[model samples]
Target chain A: MTSYIHGEIETPVGPLPRIATKWTHLDRWGALKTRWSVGRMKYRVRPGIYAVGNPDRDSRVFVTGNFKLSFDHLRRNLEGLNCWILVIDTKGINVWCAAGKGSFGTKEVVRRIRIHHLAQLVDQRKLILPQLSAPGVSAHEVRKMTGFTVVYGPVLARDIRAFLDAGLKASDEMRQVNFPLFERLKLIPVDIFYGKQYMLIVPLVFLALSGLNPQGYSFDLALNSGWKPVVNLFSGYLAGCALTPALLPWIPFRRFSIKGVVTGWFVAVPLLLAGTLGISLMEKVSWFLMMGGLSSFMAMNFTGSTTFTSLSGVQKEMKTALPAQIAMASLGLAGWIITRFIFI
Target chain B: MNRFVYLTDVVTLELDVTKCTGCRMCLVVCPHAVFGIENKRAVILNKDLCMECGACAKNCPEGAINVKSGVGCAAGIINGLLRGTEPTCDCGEGSSSCC
Candidate 1:
């Protein structure tokens, strides 16, 4: 219900809502909260027309999704500038994802433009859209449907000011998407958070399986036999989910599965050496195989977060690696069960 | 981008210079700077950098660009494998696979 009033204007969609030019502390806090929250489903705004800095008929109109973070970034970056903010109902998805899904698309843009009476509010027939939204929005179609021309702004909202100041010309740097170490590392928490259930489930299953002995269900016997398998499983999970992503570039593998296996081995070797004194050779080999497979699977999951992987490439990797991973982990688990129950 | 290169020779993006109008729409829409303008024609500058999001191909008016673009997330791929369909990034689709 928050509104900003710079000037009175009538629209086919009703009265235009107003927004502040300056972003407040609450906005920043909301952004931070949403970043850590699961799925960010609650972080969204009502979609419609909004004004910033007392925009007039000559002001530039910018289009964005109703995801609060996207909206906040767009508006906050435009502080001290007068412009028309046209938000599309994207069901809380961000511009890039929504664009891919076709929610932030030509039809929606044209509909919003007509409903908001944007042509009458702005003298210029240009609508600035986020560059990432290009996939969903066809400029030619927008122009054909509505008189407004679509001018793709910079890839990042922070560069919007510079792009606008330079007459809407984007530099090479503005166009590039940089996925730095910090950015990659920040994404780890969410990945780890989402994988938490599996993290707990896998080790607990291993522990339960390891505890079943010829002597029956004895807690002490289970604790003795199951602890190593639990540790190895957890180690593999962390190696795949956390270590592989952190050392993505330096991990010495073109494939994520390989990188994960390498990381898993890196962790497993020390544990293997430290814990091998009393355990059978089959048990040691089983731990190595299980850890390697588990880590590889976990690391492969990270392909979704990386900026370089393609859909085909991931499928290709999965085709080759997934079967190998399944074989290794399966054989290793079979070895462990045989050693604990039959050999012991 | 220079600091940490993820994978090489995986992108399917290509530019047909003969059909390119040099409108620079590819340059404008590509977040990875995969395309560059030379002699008023588009060229693939960094093919490896492409994530295949399909923005350039979608925005190209002359139909000079081609790429098999889609979300490159593994969760989406896994979901697709389970469902026996083409993988789509879960970020947009109300799925638990994405954050």
Candidate 2:
């Protein structure tokens, strides 16, 4: 274990814990672990002031949330620059989410400034905050309370060096948020991992229900009949969670639920056609309903991962989509029951 | 963003041009480049690009901007529905108990 105090870097304010911008073996391992587990929710640092590189009182001060990943990303990008980092306690949340939640608001920033006696340490009375943090922080209010001007920095930390070099004026490109393919792809793990519990429950319930048919409750019959429904359910999962996000921009509709339905049909139609060669028409209809509804439900969940939809917009979508999803799934279940008991 | 375009005309973002001081604060804070300064006033360059994060409205000294700002995540919304509350992102620093 690396001692937390192993290499204390000295600063004008005081000696503080230091870390390198480059990823260590431990960091790589942590990243892998976090990808699989709920570690992003738990990974955090003690919120306080820290120094990056050897710095005098004149060094710039940057503020951010205490989520270790957010902290690490910020510091790593500042490799050779001597600066001061004042971390606020957002309970391990990142800058963007924390700012929306009020944890990264005016009060916390003022409190951290006062507690750290930052005014005495830095000659400049200015704080550079992540642009995303602007929502919860009023620059005018911060100036009024702390006597320090808040300069909203670029949206991404990687642009900080250029932002500073250009006299703290961000270019148009620095302010834009880009959801490129890689960024979209990285979110897939979290989406799949978070949905795991529900994924397990849905399939098991479908399997158990498959056994309650008129023919017999034999495990062999259950396995034979249950496989198709289970496959259909998971097909929806793959369509909604995996395929939808990967092809997000290319997908047809603006609403994520609609996109999921479109993608779900793409996957479900082929599967239904392949598996229902000898099945009854009622069973086929049930499969179609289940596939569409499940896919839509799963796809609607992607609204959280997307960048464009607003809260009200999402609410509007759920208002329209949820009831239809419930009705379709319910009717599909009814059809399955009827086909097993009456048509069999 | 130019690379991706979300639902157009859906965001409830509005700007009072008369109230805008043309300080370009909205241009500075917005992650989506949703605003542009034209003729000493802020204009919606690409209204469809607005993510409704509210960074611009919060930072606007003139109070010229209005947006219903909140997290846009769906899991949070569904959780809110089940719990009888407004949907919110709690992945970090949020008040919601669920992640």
With a 3 Å backbone cut-off (N, CA, C), the pairs that clash in candidate 2 are: A304-B73, A304-B74
Query: Which residue pairs clash in candidate 1?
Result: A4-A18, A304-B73, A304-B74
- What TM-score, computed on C-alpha atoms, does each candidate reach? 0.90, 0.92
What is the C-alpha interface RMSD of model 2? 2.8
Q: Mind giving the per-residue lDDT tens digits that candidate 1 earns over A92-121?
A: 887877887678889999998887678777
lDDT winner:
1
**Which residue segments of model 1 deviate by more than 4 Å?**
A1-14, A21-26, A196-199, A223-228, A273-278, A342-344, B1-10, B91-94, B97-99
Native contacts retained by model 1, as a fraction? 0.67
Summarize candidate 2's per-residue lDDT along A1-344 as a digit string, tens digits.
Answer: 53222367765556777656676777667667665555566777788887777766888999999877788788878888888889999888778878887889999999999988899888898899998898789887899999999998898899998999999978888877777778777777777765666777878887777776576666776677777778887887778887888988888887888888889888977886787411888888787787778778878887776656677677778888998888888998888867777554
The numbered model that scores best in DockQ is: 1
Top candidate when judged by TM-score against the true structure: 2
